[model samples]
Target: MKHRFFPAVAALLAFGAAHAAPCPRDAPLPSGFERWAHPGLGVAAWQESGTYQATLPLGRAVTLHLPDIGTVHFIVPPGGKGSHGPYGGMIGIDVPSGATYRVMLSGRAWIDMVQDRADLPSSAHQHGPDCTGIAKIVSFPLHAGWHVLQISGAPDPTITVMMSSTP
Candidate 1:
């Protein structure tokens, strides 16, 4: 009987690969997290839900500092290596509390000389039109603890900062 219909089509493909539905678990990575390269006091933390991975050293130009807050920023451009920076860089943050944010980048962004550059303290700027600091396209808004993500240009890009969970 065709091997009993291949075991019922392999048990319906293992029940559709275990329901095949996730991503609601929320991302959260920040606890003894360590991935040193130039830890000259480098910061790459996440909470509310988490995921973190920062590895730099291909050309040399890395920066990630966000001690606490809602937090936001993500850039992963190494797919086929198109010379590197075609566009991807700019961030000025600071959010002590009341969290909420998201951002991911690869190409397309705006900012002059990287204003704020991760000093974010003037009451944690977040005042209109999505904070209005010039964040091309990615995802952003984070406050509560620290949020100082300042990624620039492209040299050793290994950006992957995912976070979701603020309830």
Candidate 2:
């Protein structure tokens, strides 16, 4: 009986360890995410209810505050739908030059890039490095100009985001 119980105890312990809490908010980011180390910007979501526009700079992290999904006016319909909740928003990004850029998010959310009134499909998608605060990373080939980043179906009202040109 003791031997059999030991296996169960060990399995429970392993599961607990595997589900440890996310890294501290101030913890240093992984190598590719170092650009997010700087101070993060806090901005509200742009919704159809009002005339609001927010811009996020590349290579800097921003804490975006999203409104209810029903309130957001995405430039283009999001490719992915939100599951956790109705929290979603949009922010503008100015790409200095045409290049592949990576967008990092701290939580699960749908990301869509729009330019010239069209949706730009993601070029690649991957998970963040272990122990990094990032939960997902999506890459897109962008051109130099203004673009809209639509965030939808976030589980929470706020999410941390960072974008940087791939080296």
Candidate 3:
């Protein structure tokens, strides 16, 4: 087969580069995170070297960032209903209203994402992924803040959080 003259252009098309962004389908946290945690319903988290906690009220989404290693986690509450999910124990996060948040990271590994809808409730367990090379990202909507957004898992991975348009 013939190759394209532009190497960058060739790679982008070959790997669906245009679609690459902090998306739920794309796990932002590094792959080694699998060794730390996998994505799922209930309280999915990672324990590095710190602690965190928060409780979302309702119809809100919270975004947490671990820029130290390039990883972002969000806890969103699906409005109303049973909030069904594959698992449980995942912390309830409080999200800011009308806000767009995103996390960015790059590496190679696997991040399993699971969420609970208002119609279905998750099991209340921990889920995660095995990240590698510092690659991961997560994006979602927010309208409030939960007592959540805690550093529950990674007791100390040397993480940090950055808010969008902070006053």
Number of the top lDDT candidate: 2
Candidate 3: give its CA RMSD in angstroms: 14.2
1 versus 3: better lDDT goes to? 1
**Residue 41 CA error for candidate 2 (Å)?**
2.8
Per-residue lDDT of candidate 3, residues 1-167 (tens digit): 24555886788797886655444655565422332222111222433112234232232223333222123333343232332222222334444464544322222212222223222222222222332222334444444443233222232333322222111
User: How high is each candidate's TM-score?
Assistant: 0.22, 0.83, 0.24
Ranking by TM-score: 2, 3, 1
Give the least accurate 10-residue stretch of model 3, judged by summed lDDT: 104-113
Candidate 3's displacement at residue 83, Å, is 21
- State the C-alpha lDDT per candidate: 0.33, 0.81, 0.32
Q: Give the TM-score of candidate 2.
A: 0.83
Weakest ten-residue segment in model 1 by summed lDDT: 106-115
lDDT of 1 by residue, 1-167 (tens): 99999999999999999888653443332231222122232344332112223322211223444332223343322122333343233232334455444332222322111112233222122211222222232333444543334444333333333222222
lDDT of 2 by residue, 23-54 (tens): 67667766677766554667655653232357
Question: What global local distance difference test value does model 3 have?
Answer: 0.32
